[model samples]
Target chain A: MQSIGKRAAMLGVFSGGAILLGYVESLIPVLFFVPGMKLGLANLAVVLALYYFGPGDAAVIQLVRISVVGFLFGNLFSIAFSLAGGFFSLAVMCLAKRYGRFTVYGVSTAGGVSHNIAQICVAAVLVENVKIVYYLPVLLLSGLATGLLIGLAGDETMRRLGAPPKFYDAVSNQ
Target chain B: MKHRERRLNRWDMALVILVLAAALAGFLLELTWTGQGASLQITVDGEVFGTYQLDKDQTIDIGGGNRCRIEDGAAWMEWADCPDQLCVRHTHISRANETVVCLPNRVTLTVLGGEDGEVDTIVS
Candidate 1:
């Protein structure tokens, strides 16, 4: 129980760090290469959480980040989009981790792609026009590209973060 | 455990190459998708003012109000009646991240993925 408590505390810290990174990234002025397009810096934290922790923990972290950050930034209207993106990305990665014939990086890529697609779906719903769905192909392609980019980065980050001491012992015992 | 990478089969390679080719084609053809230089017809309101075309002398203004111009296959809102004038100040949009918004008019224009044949508009 003592060890478990310590581990939970560690996860809490990690979650806080990830959210801070997300918030900082959000503060930067958006640079759009095309109309209504933006580089997704904050999603890096989402990738990190997915990589280091189980998807459930990642989902919790994302929910916290969205709520806290959105509140601080007065982005209440964006909450639905964030929730839609977070749920889809986390769900996809969780399933992939359990059964897909892929590595963490591939799962991370899929998560990134799913996150963007889900957000766009929410946008289309809010806008109430199918024409808004026309953004699909381009968004998907960009998500694919960004997914690969973030996946590669997440892979490197996970490798560098090293194994938690307790986690290592538990896995070896299993 | 070390992360695994799936080996790309020939099929995967072929598909990747095909998608890359399509993206290239879309980027080149994007000039034709919207605006005055565009060969495709784009109607404003009830009338077909003009299609996307880049020819400075040949371009037709849409809605008989604001002007959206096309140059070398890219589109931009060059002028508008909106006070903020953010749309007019915006750089010509060719990439997916660009957009033009007329707050007063509630008109939002964006160039979709003619560059990659996929459209990614607003992300969460």
Candidate 2:
């Protein structure tokens, strides 16, 4: 088994990568007909964490990234929306990864769809209008496109990184 | 050892197709469903503040410094104090369940007709 110090170092690196991706996403000027739409670039980091670490560790990285990014680029309402989207998306992605017949692409697409749906729910409640759901169709299209992009990036990155030597060594030793 | 190629599989392609189909269906439904001879429903924060006939050409003060105008069987946002002015810029809506939303002002205007006059029912 790896030492605790080594795990902590890895988590730190993951969080740093997540935060940097979040910053880069914020810098991209993505204009959408619907308000509060985004490409969700930070999710690439979450996918990496899921592969390298685990779901729980990935959740931690996601939460930290949302909190930090929301504080820097948004307000309380925006933070609430992000938290709703992030948590729901993470849950769906984790479930798909664990119990469903889904690869990384399927999991990421589920995450993207759930994220948009959750954000729309928050917006509907906040604005007190069910009519806001009309925006769902466009949001779904955007989610699928962005999810596919993120999933491709994640798969390529993991293929390049390969399975670490430590994992095989630990399994053989056990 | 065999290397697994990093690419989208049939399963992923199927899921993408499914989502795209759903989105397309929704768009088509929204586009084709018309609310001809419907009434204009003005809602602020989800509450129906007022309803006006689409045939009635008049301007309504929608509170919060916003105004809506109905003319020529269509309704549009005439003026809005919101920063983005998106609602004001929106095209005239004359279809069932069509809506123009002002996020900044927390106001939504929709065209309701026949069985589609359920904004209150839906909200409640």
DockQ score of each predicted structure, in the order shown: 0.10, 0.41
Number of clashes in every candidate structure? 24, 1
Model 2 steric clash pairs? B35-B96
Task: Give the DockQ-based CAPRI class for model 1.
Answer: incorrect
Predicted candidate 2 versus true structure: per-residue lDDT over A1-174, tens digit per residue: 266666776778788898899889878765764754689898999987886778898989988888888788766656777899998999989987888777788889988988998888887887687876888898889899888888888877776767535543553454
For model 2, how does the per-residue alpha-carbon lDDT over B12-55 read when each residue is reduced to its tens digit? Answer: 77888989999999888767765464787878878888877777
Deviation in Å, model 2, residue A78 alpha carbon: 0.8
* Model 1, span A37-138: residue lDDT tens: 444555667766665556676777778877877677645556655777878877987886677655655666567667767876665444332333444556
Tell me what TM-score chain B of candidate 1 gets against the true chain B.
0.43
DockQ computed for model 2 against the true two-chain complex using alpha carbons: 0.41
